[model samples]
Target: MVAALLAAVSVAADPATTASAGEQGAWFSDPVVVSGQNTAEPGIEVAPDGRLYVNAPAGLLADLPGAASFLWRSDDGGATWVLTPPGLRAAFPGGGDSDVAVDPQGATVYFSDLWVGSSTAAVSDDRGNSWFASPLSGVVIHDRQWLATSGGGVVYLAYNQIPAGVMVSKSVDGGRTFVVHSLAASVLDRSGCVCPPGTMVVEEGTGPAGLADRVGVVYATSTGGVGFARSVDGGLTFAQVTVAPARDGIDTTRAFPVVANAGPGQLVAVWQEVVEGQRTRVQFSGSADWGRSWSDPQVVVDAGTPLFPWVDANGGGKVGVSLYHTDQATLPDAAPDDAVWFERYLESLDGGQTFSPLVTVDPTPVKTGPICTQGAACAQDRELLDFQAVAIDTDGLALLTWARSIDNVADTEIRFARQLTDEATTAAPTLHLHDAVGDAITRPLPWLFRTATWSPTGR
Candidate 1:
């Protein structure tokens, strides 16, 4: 099935001819500005029809003060965007974090917002022209509600309500109602900062894990390192599987799990953790038989500390992970106020076996600050909401969005970038030194002999 899908629209890049130099250098489009200022916690969704929706809790200059959330809609991919009215805040008092999801069948858009201690969502059937907002029935989602929609319009939301365990909710009738299920009995600590929220997805078909048509969820636990749950019978019943065992007496909030279905039955999950008391690293695990079991966790990237790791998988065997790594050599000073942070992305074409070198998405470190200012000096803190977002289209183009300070640390703004999955073209190949090893290294070179061309999958 994966082969069939890839073969259907696969393009054989011209073998690096002299005339193909410019096209070969076009592996990725230049950074496209998604929003100008005053927005954080950017949640983006790309519809099957090529529409783009980005949502944030607050800070959008276009939105009123009481407006709970701000939305930006783009019809021609991400080239141009317009603000959707601030109706979401009218539904919830005092804004919190929010995320967006879309139903492919009807182009129905679902936007979930956390506010005033409860999680609520809005639905848009006619793209972003209009919306219907309401509170989720089954659970009072306390933290970030990461929503995922199945092809059949089945919406799954995963959240963490401290002292009540991590929960997964299902909404079959669009975003109108929900059925919540508890995957864990208790969180690591009700008082500790909210453990990073869990992530959920409905398998496309029989998953690589051998579980056909199952709804799977992966979450971070205070007591347990990482937990997995799946409902083979839709959203009715669920059983747990151990992905990563808990570290004795260690806080698990540092380990936020992000899961995605790569292809037919293939699953990939990534997160971050504080290991050996001082070092922090991004951990990855995969399941080929659904959520029943998982492979041993492995470190994918490590700097001084990696945070807010986000993961997404393409229908082909490609997986992309994005996170920011900061170098903090001293304790207590762990969250460096003047640190040079690398907003990096790593890609894997053959599942998780190997990953491309860290790809810096931001032109410069967050330390470079803002290019413009909106309000008072932006608070010098690790802020970008909970996590950034990444999505891949049928054409194998990866769209990534994140919030960053505009001028050093003056204002917040949302940024977007595109990367080609099949291959990244370059006028010519480049070189790099071996890390500490003297031998030069060059493998998996996609641009050496080929250039990527577009072929609509008609997905």
Candidate 2:
């Protein structure tokens, strides 16, 4: 143990801290924003020690630059971060899109990187300290999904570059190699985009507390309908299940799914579905026997237009979820349909059989400026916005990080709300943090694709 340390430094609340005493959901005191670096891509992870470790991409990190273009770790968790000696950036010269993953035991860490213009992989052994770059034999240009590692094993999600199908690969003897397999094994091309085969998409992880496939599921949309597939053999193979069965010739796209494996065979999955000209709904489905069958789809958000369905790793045998939506109807892609919406930062207290709606993740008065539909020019809009990650504070309190930024620069400050809610039951529906916070996070960091993990396995 390094004895958990923080050097002596001056501390004061920056005046930009906003406090709302009258709002129904505001319980923020004097919260502070921890400023970050400009170059490294920032993402937070909770270590086995129950502290936050923030991974930042290459270039002599402000604190630490463990590996190459990859990420670093923080012993004091996110409170204080550092860079290790050998890094992920040094390992993968073909670096492109990089993602972080922790072992099932939480004792090891993994960094997954993509090759530029393609779907190649390079991974880290340590928590970002060092890594090895291995060519994933047959894989061409697939996208990176949630990365998982257990002891020397490695698993990942990827989509076909053409037909837009889903695929997953695994390296049983660590990330040195892989066994590739196609998921959602359906033959569906794009919606008339004369492209080659299409690729699949993946999501963040829910650790061991999450469902069978962890947090990765493959959904394919075709002239037929949208179908679902999940991997249990560490992503080496997948079994299909229909998420949105064919009804209207309408198709399903962007079906983000997350699961929680309650027990040996009990699993639960949730995803979002859109009806072209109608509403998008978030629904929950469960299976008591490992992917053998699923429960009747329960519409979690039936009254509103759902946009996203995200899940968090709930500590005590549960999973947390965030649902984003709007009730005020607007024509598809219409103007100013914008509104500060509410969400249920829910937790499956009984492992998916029940839920508790917690406080709103996104703050009130709106988080960021309206969506910029101007395409390429939208990235140029620098504006003050809100952004934060969820942290488990106490037994009943969840820490929601809230901050503001403008022009991708720090215009305001960051603040967090300590949500005091009942952990035993489903919390109430609250707001989600979707109003594009800072342009910085969404900004592209081409140089960061090479960083790795920083734990002991880097050796």
Candidate 3:
């Protein structure tokens, strides 16, 4: 006997919010302050139980002592947040960038930073209540250290391998020990230093039997292009694939690639670049059957110069990309004036075939200025060190987070906005029924069936 009760969902445009549905289907929320105490290079993640975690460089030059990092947690989603107690201080005296990730169960949280001579991490197993610090076993992590945790507690850390290539350190037993895997490109040019952080996603290992669990990482190579590396047997070894060919305008300021696993064997990656004769724009491509192949690149956002594009995907083929955009000059021209910079977003409900309209995320305007550090390069770039982040909750809400320089760069604050659209509303898990085995079953449609293997007797 099969009996299921699922709520009927509908679609309508929400006019009061920027996440309104239109020609391309969009949903954007108002900006809210996660923290006002000088946050930089923010990283955001959502727990399985609806908790939100954000970590970043705590403050500017005047906020603290000995290069500190800040941790913030929200029990009520992103509606509110509080700074985690006992902040982490750098083992060394310098700070460049940091990233954070939570275990699949949300029982453990990990934060990474450049230590005295290598990349180190601060771990909290008690849901950010406390912490302990340690190095990444044997590898030397560069300035931008990124962290990602698999459902089975495998921790993967990716960073630049000095002169060339990207190295990933994997730990199967909750980061106790690591096996480093190198993914070097033959065309890696070291003459110019441009090492962007590599973004990784652990494939959902719930597919058919005999399918090797995969972990994918995407980053920009020294050549002005994006490279993808996949590991089939955990993180022991990796095979590389070029998502986009090398171009002429691949600089640290313009080339940031973000990647995500949409579903079983479905992967998507996005990055920003300038063609030799075209304007700067964001290009996207994906692979339905893992990284064995990928679709051609297509422009997703090109209103102005879309800087630092970041992408994230959910289990149901929903992908989100966020970036700091500016309406500057096109390629082959001098750097355009640093006009007002704003945050923008793009989403694809059906993998990478189509995307929603270019939606403006933050309503506030950000102004850039010359670097205040004496003797620094004469580049008038905005202080956005890294890229923004987008994470989808189980309920299909997209939470976009970033550090916005407000009040004329005098104080940078961590900010975020929530976006919800008709697609998300219809996909909401409003009603769930249990099967004969007492496992919760969520049926989006009468014909679409999904199962959770839970035992009522005991584990």
Candidate 4:
């Protein structure tokens, strides 16, 4: 019965061809709800085999014994998905935060879950069929943990160690166990904002000679800036550098910065900064020489207040960023009744040199109420959670997954939007939604299944 229920919940949607009024370019397929259970703070990654893996707090499945989080796998790109529960919550049953990472060869997939004072990294060798868990050491308190993998058996995990700043752990035996490698940042360097480290990446050392594979991470700095820490010696020691300096009125406590490796030593970082205490804007800076030097920060989007900025790059200067955006100039707490928030995306074909105009990935409003930035302490309306994720797929198109609030009910579900390419429009894949037991689910179609004319724009 449980398997049938899970199978019944699996759903797939055809790409909507007609662009809405405000959605002029129609660069992305219409948003599709991928999770039937309540889940938020989604993390996404595209495997080498073109499979999409997403992890989030188990939500409704929290009561299931040992169920830490839900791993949603999409074998047919983003059209259909299947949920696999990772029963890795022996220590902390109530899952806190979760992240997903795929190794280079796509043979090993890593999912890290955070508990109250500890965390677990679960490894799946056969995709998401089964997973073995391993505890992460080197941190007294674990908050938000992120995983990154390189060639060989190397895996790096970074998380917030509370007042002690961000700490990193390394796994040499294919994530079987992790040992403390080094501190990405100490308390002295940060402003005491228990902000978790942003998306971590392993540069494959394809740059200049003598440049070994470098592991890099970005975090909030003490002076409302973005601090980057990189280790070339395999996490033994790290050198920290400032990608962006302090801005006078910017708030570092809520500003989380994210970094992505464009190619070799080329890196790009993006963060949100409050302006005049009224609104927030997204800004980005690029580093051509690893983390040693950074370009002056430039505004990526200034029309409205943006939150939870995430950046991902796919080599050769191709970069993508996703964020929760609202046209209201006021903070989320002060949003008016008509204020609506949507998932907005921007692309850069030439690294961070220039960005395309902001494209609304989803026509649906993700949230309509005050979005509390206070983590874990918020009393109401915290459904959207901390961040949404964007990953460049094997086809070099953007794939985005985020949480959408359910009619201001304080509950949220995962939604996915895929960038539409010329090939995708001509040959739309048949939709296939399945249940946990791999049974197909058939249902009446909606407008999402309707076909219309769509032209590739600005690709």
Candidate 5:
């Protein structure tokens, strides 16, 4: 039965396409500005009811006393957005890194606010109108915090704990309270850099019987490698797996690896590494049996210097990866140049086996020069922060949020872009079924359809 299912959804015949020099006829709608003030390091999520939510640190708003992160909601997709009321202070008042996640049933929305030495998690049931905030108790000094949710009121918060390592806290009673679930990484794994962990995802256990839902996270290890931690029994315990071994040119400070679930027991990891000639490329690897093993790393984009890569997957083998790309090959400390940077996206219909032609989400340059990698220490060109986010909605349309620097120094704003075409229809049909023997199975049907295009206004 397993062999039959694999044959039905095989994507080996689909050839990979090269990155095109021209845009694909407005494949992505014009980016809509989502923030009125300067904000960086944006994160986005789509609730089950199709409501969109974006969160970021209160950049200029932080100057005001008792100010927290910013939250924006959109009912009419990405066409327009409304900012929530200001001064929703968390436990720490001083807002830093921000992340947002919604429960599987869309009954609750979770948001994280990271301050200098600690962090807080907020929950909202009636959208963003009201929120109840609680301080995360497991970690004493939290650097960056990310949220992930699954069925049964399960929520996982992953973050770096000062000089220790990566820690994950679980909240089974909605987001009211949380306790340390497990240590994703140890002090030995972190070496000395308290690098932030990538996005966290809860993979529904739709495989054989007795298999429970799994929570997975990826982060940069001290040995210059990518580490993946998986918890099969909810967030009770996690076993770390080395997705990619130590490499010579990997910059541990900024080498944040992101993981996404394409299907049951199927995971993909994407990160950035410097090549032989000092050119940085986005690399990805795939695992069919959860995080037990991973395929050799493959280049997703090598034409330009890519930074802050993010990945998200849906359906059978459909995956989307987004990153900031620039043609100039300059060092991080190089002076500001005329080089232009844009946000680029690539999709895969067959899991991570192959990818389609690169699509520029926005033609406008987000930044004009070198981006400072030194956190909070760089004196210039640090407006656009470290990471951006990408989410595949229920309709399989990609939604992206990132910070754009207008002056390349301090003036920054949050912007959003959405895929205009219905890429989900073009892929094979995904079906989850139970075998005759009673074990669960997931596979794609032998059928395909032409791509359909739509505009944001029509939706």
Candidate 6:
């Protein structure tokens, strides 16, 4: 039955909440905004029916006219979102970062973006209301990363071939047909200049089959280091490397590198480093031989770096990381620091060899500019680029979404918290119930029976 449910949870999926059993450092509980509409620049994913597939970036920026961009959906899992009314657009003119995946058993629901000069692609399978501006054969689908789904139809697209760096694409018969492959060059140093938006994953049992589908890729290199790739099928082929490996001191600050394999072979990542004097910490890494090797970093959150981690092992893996903390040396232009912020620590135990001291899925401190535009570089030059992601359902609950800058632009509209599933009675229980038997219920787990088919054994 789908490889027996992906080989029995394959990896990462055991945390009935109740802090899974509490005491990893428990404190999680405070985050709830869900849907959004302050105006343009939104992109989130996580929808097969579990809901939370937002995509509102109404971007009228240079397109002048107005309202043309859309794709808003939030069916409760995201708290309260609804605007499929007449959005979803990308004839090109700023409507970036929108990658959603859902085809584990076939109702079909996938979305992708990246239309700058125009390789022309604005696909959607009815989940976002509507969209279809295809042209991927035009051969220009750079830095894309959706990775997953070997369930039978095939859908694995790990991209980044711009200027020349990173590649792995496959649609099998599912994503509509694709098969691009070009991996390893020490794993991308490709002339340099990446970092517009790059985050990939794939490398557990290795995708398409065996249920270990994880193909990871992260780019933001001035060389600050963050570019790796691995495709266990699904994406077809890949095996690149270049890790900044060496946590504790944290160091990365170029901020933006979040990977997730959760199981199969275990590979979790986090990024945000600017450690010359220390303050931009948010470092965590792992690779159970998938990327060859890694492990020896843990700084959780301090200067913060826009991290988002999720793993609920029905087999044994549970973690959720999200940290922002930015005023950038005192309002380096106020950036995304509208002020009232805090999603802190968050812990649900069961998957930790090093970092595990979180528990604030939503304690609500809230504050960080909602500026949708001022100079816009993901808003005043990347302060953490408005949330964009954090998902986990099937009974674990911890869906997060963010984007509310103050002066940089895109204001008060995209917000979500979820963190449901509790049971910690008290010791300090103001609201720290990371769930153990805390039940909030969010069912939807399929596609893992070791991954369902397609293996090469890392050759």
Worst 10-residue lDDT window, candidate 1: 4-13
Error of 4 at 95 (Å): 1.3
Per-residue lDDT over 345-452 for candidate 5, one digit per residue giving the tens place of the 0 to 100 score: 877667765555456778777898788767778787878778888888877778998888887778888899887765455456454433334465556643223354
The sequence of per-residue lDDT tens digits that candidate 3 reaches over residues 208-322 is 3213557777766656667777777666677778777766754423445777767667777887676554556777878776776666666666555566678877667677888
Give the top-scoring candidate (TM-score). Answer: 5
* Candidates arranged by TM-score, highest first: 5, 4, 1, 3, 2, 6
Task: Please give me the total number of clashing residue pairs in predicted model 5.
Answer: 0
The lDDT for every candidate, in the order shown, is 0.61, 0.40, 0.60, 0.71, 0.71, 0.45
**lDDT rank order:** 5, 4, 1, 3, 6, 2
C-alpha RMSD of candidate 6? 21.3
lDDT of 5: 0.71
Candidate with more favorable, higher TM-score: 2 or 5:
5
- True-structure RMSD, every candidate: 7.8, 13.5, 10.3, 12.5, 7.0, 21.3
The 10-residue segment of model 6 with minimum total lDDT is: 450-459
List ranges where model 1 is wrong by over 4 Å: 1-27, 59-66, 179-185, 188-196, 204-213, 248-252, 327-338, 368-380, 407-410, 420-443, 447-459
* Cα-based TM-score, every candidate: 0.78, 0.62, 0.76, 0.83, 0.85, 0.28
Tell me the tens digit of each residue's lDDT in model 1 across 386-405: 56777776665667778776
For model 1, what is the C-alpha lDDT against the true structure?
0.61
Candidate 5 worst ten-residue window by lDDT: 8-17
Q: RMSD of model 2, in Å?
A: 13.5
Off by over 4 Å in 5: 1-22, 60-65, 86-92, 190-193, 204-212, 332-336, 422-453, 457-459
> What TM-score quantifies how close candidate 4 is to the native fold?
0.83
